[model samples]
Target: MKYFALLFALFFINFKQKTDKLIGRYSYLIEDNNSYIQKDKITFKDSVFVFDNKYMPKGKISYGNAILLENFINTSLVITIPKNQIEKDTIEFYMHDKNSSSANYLDEVTGKGRLIKIK
Candidate 1:
């Protein structure tokens, strides 16, 4: 029983370390009907994700916490913001590349986007 407990603890720690590789910065461009392009930035660090929009008020930022979930043996990260917080949507990022430098993300409301590691 002791051995089983120790093994489970190690596994959890290892899983966390693997998910930590997603920590980095990413940028994406949003095109509007007016033919204008808007750039957005998102950064993942520790267990928090920060999103910033260039046109937003100075010093304004959106914050969300991330949770790593396992589905049928595959792992994914989901970022969720409290309902009382900013109106921005939640995002789910699935790590694809082995290096964890890039991911495919789906915003809860705005569809999907490619998250390329910039840092």
Candidate 2:
């Protein structure tokens, strides 16, 4: 029994480390009013797809081969980016809405930001 518990602990630790390798500290530059604004540091948790932001509740993020999607729990809406849409230094975000349309970040919650890898 003791051996089994030790094995389980080891497995869990390894699992966390592997997933944490993919997740770490990152920042998003929010585009607003013809200006690029910086949001803040967001810490991503592995396995569960959660991001930490002090201004709001926990945010859930989904990742694909090239794009990372985020959904807020309080409003509970899905935001995503298609894999093919990534450019040299910018990522586009599509708004979650009834109508299918490109999201405009001038005055909208779902805004696209040019992501720079800072980790």
Query: Please, what's the RMSD in Å of model 2?
Result: 8.4
Q: Pick the lDDT winner.
A: 2
**Model 1 lDDT per residue over 9-100, tens place:** 99999877523233557664333453423356766565444557543322222333543322212233332333232222323233222224
The TM-scores of all predictions, comma-separated, are: 0.31, 0.46
The segments of candidate 1 whose C-alpha lies over 4 angstroms from its true place after superposition are 1-17, 29-38, 54-110
Cα lDDT of candidate 2 equals: 0.52
Report the C-alpha lDDT of model 2 over 27-48, residue by residue, as the tens digit.
5666788787776655546523
Q: RMSD of each candidate?
A: 14.7, 8.4
Top-TM-score structure, candidate number: 2
Computed on alpha carbons, the lDDT of every model, listed in order, comes to: 0.41, 0.52
**Candidate 2: clashing pairs of residues:** none
